[model samples]
Target: MSGFEVAGVVIGALPLVITALSAYKQGKEVLASLRKFRGLLDGLIHQLQTQKTAFYLDILEHLREAMVPEILQYGDPTEEKCVGILLDAKTGTQMHDYLGPLHEPFLEIFGYYEKYLKEITSQLDYIVRLKDAPKDDLPNIIRASKIQNASLVFKGRLKFTIDRKTLDALVKDLGTERYSLGKLIKRVKTKREWEANEPTSSSTTLTLAFARVRESATLLHKDSLEVPTITVTETCDQLIHATARVQVKSICDDAQHSRNQGRVLALELMSDALGLSEAKHKPHQSYNISTTLADFLRDTAQDEDARMSPLNQTLLALNVVSSVLQLRPTVWCNIPWNSMSIRFPIRLEDDLRIPVCAPYVELAADANLLQSHTCSPKFDHDSCQDDHARDGHSTVGDITSQVHGGLGNKEPTRRHGNIHGPDACCHLLVGVEHEQIIASPCQGD
Candidate 1:
C-alpha cells in the first residue's frame, strides 16, 4: 500500500481497537478470567487513544503554520481528512506544492506508525474474538501457554492470552513505539521552528560580502586571509548586528533628508546621533600580539646578516595590504596602519624557523603608545646600522624604519635618505637584496 493508504489504515484501525477493547471489557462478569485482564484492556485502550490524539491533533498543530489555505479548504486537519487528501491521486501534486519540504517527513512519520499499528490491530482483533467465544472456549483461550514464556516477540506476531508475561510483552512493545513516535514529533517541531527563524536574506548578503573579501585577499596572497572558524551562534549574532546597523543607518538618513526638506523628524535623528556618540566613546577591546613584523625583523637584524629575503619582504608587504583592506571598513580599523600593527606568527620545524608573513589584526593595550611615538629612523639606525656597517651590509631594521617612516610622513620630504615617497621606499626595499648580492663578490675581492 502507498504511505497515504497505510496512514489511513492505521488511523481507521485505532478506533476499532479501542471499541473492541471496550466491548471485551463488558464480558468481564461472564468470565472470571476476563476480570483479571481488565487492567490490561484499559491500558491498551488508553494507549490507542493517545496515539490517535497524537496523529490527529499534536502533529497537525505543529504543521498548521506551514500549511496553505488550499489544504485547509478540504476541512480541518483531522487524521481522516489529512489522509484522505493525501490518498487522492488528484491532490498528489497539491501535497508537494503546498507542503514543500515537509511532505516527505510527514509521510515518513505516518509510515512509522503504520508499521507498529498492524501488529497492534491484529492482537486486538484476537481479543475481540475471545469476547464472543462460548464460556468453555473462553477458558481454553485463557490457558497457560509455554510459547509466551519461551521468548519475547518485540515486533512480530504476538501470542495472545490472559497470562501476565504475554500481556506485559505487548505493553512493552507499545511503549517502545510510543517513545519512538514522541521523538519523531519533537524532531519535526524543531525543524519547523528552525525554518521559521532562518535569516535567509541576511545570510545571503553576509556570504556575498565575505566571498568578495576572500577574493580580494586571495589576489594578494593565497594564505593571507586565514580567518578562524566562528561558531554558529557568533556568526548569527554578527549577521543580525550588521543587518540592524544597516537598517538603522538607512532610517536615520531618511529622517535627515526629511528634516532638510522642512519636515521635522526628531526621534530617528536623535537616535542616530546617540548611536554614533555611544560607539565613539566606548573603550577599545584589546588583544595581545606575540610578535609584530617590525619586532621580528628587528630581533633577526641583531644576528650577522640575518635579514629577511627580498621575496619574503614583498610577500609580507602584500599580506599587510590585504589585512588593511579587510579591516578598513570594520570597527577594528580605529588604529593607524604601521609596522607595529603588522604581526608575524612563528613556527618551528626540525630546527628550521618559518615565520608566517601575515598581519594579525589584534590590537594590544599599549597600541596608543605606537600612535603617540614619533616616527624617527635615527634611534634604530644608530643601534643597528653600526652592526650592519661592520658586517658590510645594511640591516632589515633600516628597510622597516624607512617604510614605516614614509607611512608616517604627511607629505613627501627630502629627509630620511632622500626617499621621495612611500612608493619610493617600497621600490628601494624591493631591490635591497639584489644590491647586497652584487656587492658581496666585490667586497670578497
Candidate 2:
C-alpha cells in the first residue's frame, strides 16, 4: 500500500530481468559462432571433394595419355599391328611427377597401409615365434627380403609426405642442425651403395629388368601418409623382374621343367576353353617335349595327331599373349592368364574357339596354322566373315593359306566347325578389352 513496498518489489524483479537479458545475448553469440563453424566445415568438405576429383581425373588422364601414344593416335591400321612393336616409354622425370596430387577422397591410402601393416606385422610375428632365427631361415629370409623391399619403397616415397629437408636435427645445446634420418637411413644408403658397386654390365638383362621393376613400381607410388605403399610395390616389382629373368633364362637354356612351369597351366586353360578339356591334364611330358609356341606349331604342322592335341589351342593362346605383350608389356607381366577366349570373324551358331595370333604374339612366317581360321568350338553361325563387324572394319581377318596355312588335317573334330572359306588372312583378335584390371587369381605362375 505504501511507496516503499512498491519500490522493494520493483528492485527484486530488476536483477532477474538483467540476468535473463544477458543469457539471451550469450545464446545468440554462441548460435552465430556455430553457424560460422558449420559454413567453414562445408567449405572444407567441398574443397576436399574437388581435390579428390582432380586426383582421380589426373590418374585417368595419365592412363589415357599412356595408351593414346601406343594405339589411339595411330591413323594407319597397318601401324596398329603391334605384333613386334616395342612401345616407347615415358621419361623418368615425367613418371616421378605423374601423380599430380597426393590426397584422395576415397581414402584408399588408409586401406593400403592397413593391408601392409597387417601383412608385415604377421610376417614379423612369424619370425618372432621362431626365437633366435638363423639368417638362413627360409621364412625369416623371405620376411627380411620383404623388409628390405619396404625400406627401398620408403626411400622412393620420401618426397611425398614428410619433407626429407626437414629431417635435420636441431640440437638445442649444440645449436646445430645435423642431417638425420636416424639409423635405418644409413643402413639403406649403405645397401644401395653396395648394390651400385656391384658389377652389372656383364649381365645384359640386368639393366632391362631393373628398369622394368622401377617403371612398374612407379605405378603404385602416390602422395599419401596413411599407406606404406611404396615398400610393398617396390618388393613386388623386384620379385617380378627377378622371376622374369629366371624364366627367360630357363626358356633360352631349354630347362624343360622350369620353362614349362606356368606355361603348362596357361596352355591347359586355353586348351579347356578351346573344347579340348582332355588336354588340360596332359602329362608334363608333353610340355617337356614341346617348350616354345613355335615348337608346338611345328609339331602341329608336321603331325595330324598334333592338330587334335591340346597343343593346337596352346600355341594360339601363347601367340595371342605374346602379341599383346609386344604392344603392352606391363599388362601381362603379372597376369597368370588362366582363362582366355578368342573369336574369329567367321561366326559359329555357338561360341567357337577360333585361333588367331594373339595381340602380342609374333608368329614366324613359316609357322602356318594347320587350318586357316580354324577352331573347334562348334562353329555353327551362318553369318559370313564379312558380317563380323557391324561396320566394314572387320573385327577379325579371315585366316587363309595365303597368310597362315590350314592345319591341313581333316580331323572330324575340326570339321565340326563351319568354315565358310579360308581365303582371307586371319586377323587374330583377343577377347580381352584394353585397360581392364584382371583381379582374378593370376598368381598361379
Candidate 3:
C-alpha cells in the first residue's frame, strides 16, 4: 500500500481502539484483575484521541501547505468537508492522486509506525473479544466446576493470557511516536516561518517589515483586545527588518491611568532576540540571548555609574511590583521567576535612562517545568534563594539584603532606604531609596 493509504489506515484504526476501550470501561461488570487496567485504558484512550486530533489538525495542515496545488484542486483544505473527503476511505483513489508526489516523505515519517499501529490494534481487538466471550465458550480450566466464582475464574484466565508488560511497552512506544510526530510538526512550522521571511528578489522595505510585525502583533492580541493597535516610529529602526521599536499602548480603561501610563516601551521580537541573521544561515540551530538580567545586574553592581538614579531605581522597583500584581494571576506568570529568564531590550539612543522598557521573560524549552516551579509550595522563598545563590550568596535574606547583595552593595544607600519592608518583595530588586514612595515585593510568602 502507498504511504497515504497506510496513514489513513492508522488514523482510522485509532477511533476503533478508543471506542473498544471506552465500551469495555462502561460494561456493567468488570473483573477485579481487569479493573487495574482502568487507568491505563483511560490514558491510552486519551492519548489515541490526542494523536488522532494532531494528525487531522496539525499534520494535515502542514501537508496541505506543502502540497497546496494538490489540496486546492479538490476544495479549501481548511474546511471540514474537504478534510473529511480526504480522510474518507471511499475517496482513496482521489487522495492517492493528490498525495502521490509526497509519497516518499510521508513514508519516511510514518513507515516505522505501521507495525506499532497494527500490533496495538490487534491486541486491543483480542482484549475486546475476551471481554465479550461467554463462560461456556471459555477454556475448560476457566469454566471448570472447580472454579465456583465466575469473577475469580475470569481474573485467573486474564492473568494467564494477558501480558501487562507488553501492553505497557506498547503504550510507551505510542507516546514516543507521538513525541516524534510533534517534533516533525515543529520542524515544519520552523520551515514555514523561515520561508515566510526569506528575502524576496526585491530588497525588504521598512513598510513591508512594519506591516508584517503589525499583522503578527495583531494576531497576538486579537483574542484579548477588541481593536489592537500597534504604533511604531518610522525612525526608531536599529535593525530595520529584524527589529522594530514599537509601543504596546493600553486600550483598557484601568491600564491607561496606571503608572508609567501611555509609556511607549521598546519592544523586541523573539526572532530578533534569538539572532535572525544567524538563523538565516543555520536554520535548525537554537539560539538564546547571551545577556540576561543576572549579567546586567552583575555588571551594574560592579559599575556604580551605570546604576540607576534614586528616582529611577524607585520607578524600576515600582514597575516590577506593578507587573507582578497585574500579570501574576494570568498565563503570563507561567514562567521561571529566576534572573536568567528576565531580559532587558537592546538600548536605543532615546531610551529612558532607568531602562523604562519592560523586561522580557524568555521561556525555557520545557514550559511545564517552569509552571510547576512557579506553583511549588516554597516558590516565593525558593525564587529568592535562586537569585541569591546565583550571586554567590548561600542564604536568602530579607528582600533588601537579597537585592543589595545581588548588586554587590556593602550597605543600602540612604536614598534607596524607603524601598525595604513587605513592599520590596520582587524577582528584580534595585536599591536607591525614595522616601515618599513605598515599593512592594514582587513575590512573597
lDDT of 3 by residue, 1-445 (tens): 5455556555545554566566655652566435666456666667778777776665566545556345556544443334344455545554344444543565565655556555554444323223445422312322232345555433221221236676677677667753456566565557657767897533355345456655555544553443222222223222321111111111121223332344332322342221112122211222223456677667777888887665555555445543332233333345566567666655434443333245666543332433332321122234444544566643223333554343343243432332322122322322222111112112222
* Global local distance difference test of model 3: 0.44
RMSD in order of candidates = 22.7, 33.8, 30.2
What TM-scores do the predictions have? 0.34, 0.15, 0.31
lDDT of 1 at 11: 62
Residue pairs with backbone overlap in model 1:
none
lDDT of each: 0.47, 0.30, 0.44
lDDT (Cα, 0-100) at 72 in candidate 2: 48
Q: How accurate is candidate 2 locally (lDDT)?
A: 0.30
Q: Per-residue error at 370 for model 1, in Å?
A: 55
Q: Pick the candidate with the highest TM-score.
A: 1
CA shift of 314, model 1, Å: 39
Worst lDDT 10-window in candidate 1: 436-445
Error of 1 at 302 (Å): 73
